[model samples]
Target: MRISGPTDRRGVTAPAAGRWSAGRARPRVLFLATSYPVYEGAAEGVFVARLAESLIPFVRVLVLAPCPPAAAKRSPRARGRKRVRVVCLRYAPARLRLLAQGPGGIPASLARRPWLWVLVPALLWAMFVGARRALRGACLLHAHWAVCGAVGGLAARLRGRPVVTTLRGEDVNRAARSFVHRLVLRACVALSSRVVVVSEALAQRVRRLVQAADPIVIPNGVGPEFFELDPPSRGDHFEVLFIGSLIPRKRPDLLVEALRTVPGARLTLLGDGPERPHLESMARAEGLSRRVRFMGQVAPERVLEYLSSAEAVVVSSEREGRPNALLEAMAAGRAVVVSDFDGAAEVVEDGVSGLMFPRGDADALAARLRSLQEDPAMVRRLGQAARARMRSLGLRWEDTAARYARLYEELLSEHGGAAGEDGMERGGRNGAA
Candidate 1:
């Protein structure tokens, strides 16, 4: 019942201020997400944090996310020059709060430890209560995932505010397979003033759930750091980087298996998940321990380091929704070998911008890696093409934020709560940022 107020970078309690009550020029947006970066440079949901940061110039952003066990005593990191206020909601006992962290996110955590289902009600209730408290002066609610959208939808209904729900990868891919999840997703979509899907594949899935739903397709954008990375010189051995959770869905094990055929390639797995131990054991059993390095969950800067030094980046996932990692690797101008998931074609032009292999096919993946290893010219060609594609597509965080800002204005005007004239001008200026 006790919701903490927003705190500054120094962890000092700030005064309770609302958008209109405080006489702010911009409308306030409350971002509801189950996963968010707890500290600066943290890899967890960095996209959400980045989007929130990019939106700051146009609107006031307040992110509400679950407090991880490690960050229980401290406040979430304030990132970028323009700070976004992040309020961490404590849902359960510190030790028992394992729902939102690690790989696979909420559904994966629940699947791994079914007993943790006991905390679901507590988490939902906590989010609802915290959202209501945070909605005091907020004009609209922006929920990151369907679960948060469901909670935000209810809160917005009560407060008579609009809710904008963004359906990320797992929320649509995994949630559609279950009856209860499908029902919840339907309700979330029904209650949303606007629905945004990160990929065309996800948008298709949303339509299947609700035929009338017209979800906007907006892929997640890469930070400027990725684009500014210097091109890596070709090494003696081809360095292949896999930069995502080691969860089953991500299929990092496929990359490890692919390495067996690619003797000249060294693989660096730069993420952590429940499958890490199993993958490590698999690597050792296959006598590939030395060749496969498991670098579990580094900071964002470290991720950029790995991306910059790699000859090629591989995404061996079985499913995805326009992965930010893929976009970032391409932006960094690294030759990418991505599995041909549903929406793979939308981002990469297969043989042109990047290489794609059949999903879950280790031999095909190995072939792609071997080709990249042997053909440095092709690698450079593809890398440059990928970078050019990103540039032409305008896949920057500021651009994405500008699109969302316009949508927010349209929704606000429809609901008779549009921002003031200054706010509209600032929203239009997002492109110049």
Candidate 2:
């Protein structure tokens, strides 16, 4: 990693061909994301990093994201190993960075530390400045969330560039709950050249927020890395896996409650969040401190290992755009039980590739878990079917990245044509080309 500009303090060197050029106008894209993997192999928003990596071969991608204050001590190698360049802007003080708005998403972070609200202006200003600096001679901008989209859209508008925004789960479900957030998000959607959502359910929500909003449905793709590893054989004890932030929406507490009904069943949670202590206390109260294991946060590769070892994977999120956990588990040949909310039904077919239960229903969830435990053959069959379904869907990261590349090309063509028309308008009297 080498420094390039004043604002470009951190960067990851890409492939020989993907490096920045000062003489030629290569098709470049600026990505605005608030949540990204901070540490090496950190589990936070690894999908964002994966998508950025996948897009590197197609275009010169530069990511402008917020770095958690506490991550000032991050190892040099923790940035990433890909063609995409990332510059993390620190908005909070060093000691307070851990409480800043980055990790468990803006909603959860704000909930954890309300005083951080004072830093919102600084955070947005930092992103604005970073986006302005990164957008020099860039053809397109793609923001990962509504907030980022709003900020990045302003920067792109200033540069007269086309901007696209992807409304992943929380941007619509959590942030959109607030009146001010809805207003800002609607403005962002209005400014976006294209609005992309991971699921049709989210597209519908976007339409409600902005009546004229017509969002394209682009599901998140599973990477080939997850498919390369084979799952370990199931054991005698019924073991299930839950891999996501332990937030209220994730409903890990309900998963623990369901385990109480299933007697000897074990649940291993593989991510950390603000809700961990409360969830642990709930599990202890139910006398399940022994069966429920909180693995905290693990490396991205270890997630696949845990998925490979488990008999089934459960996604108990009350609201989601598209959970990588569900998709990765499906791709890894493991039976999945997802909550019947948000986009769960879009990816899962009940009694087919996986099972879907009503959210917050511990009894229903326990019944489904017990059924799989009683019939190991059904578990294996479901898992096999899930793997096949994922393959048939053709949800590969390479393909997903190519689709965005096509979109970027279209935007660049539009921009070029617009510029040409404006030039002719300015010098039509002189017959200028």
The lDDT for every candidate, in the order shown, is 0.82, 0.75
Off by over 4 Å in 1: 1-24, 73-75, 418-433
Query: Per-residue lDDT tens digits of candidate 1, residues 1-433?
Result: 1111344444432222322222334677889998898776567888898898777656778888987787866555777655788787888888888888657788778878999899999999999998877777677889999988888889888877789999987778766688888878888888898999998888998898878789998778888888888877877678999998888999999998889999878899998988999999999999999899998988876788788789999998888888988999999999999999988898899889999999999999999999988899999999999999998887888767777877776788777754223222222232221
Worst 10 residues of 2 by lDDT: 424-433
lDDT of 2 by residue, 195-273 (tens): 8998889998888877889999877889787776575465766889999887788888889889988876888999888
- How does candidate 2 fare on TM-score? 0.88
Candidate 2 residue spans exceeding 4 A from truth = 1-25, 77-82, 99-103, 417-433
RMSD of 2: 8.1
- The candidate that wins on lDDT is 1
TM-score of each: 0.90, 0.88
Clashes (candidate 2): 1
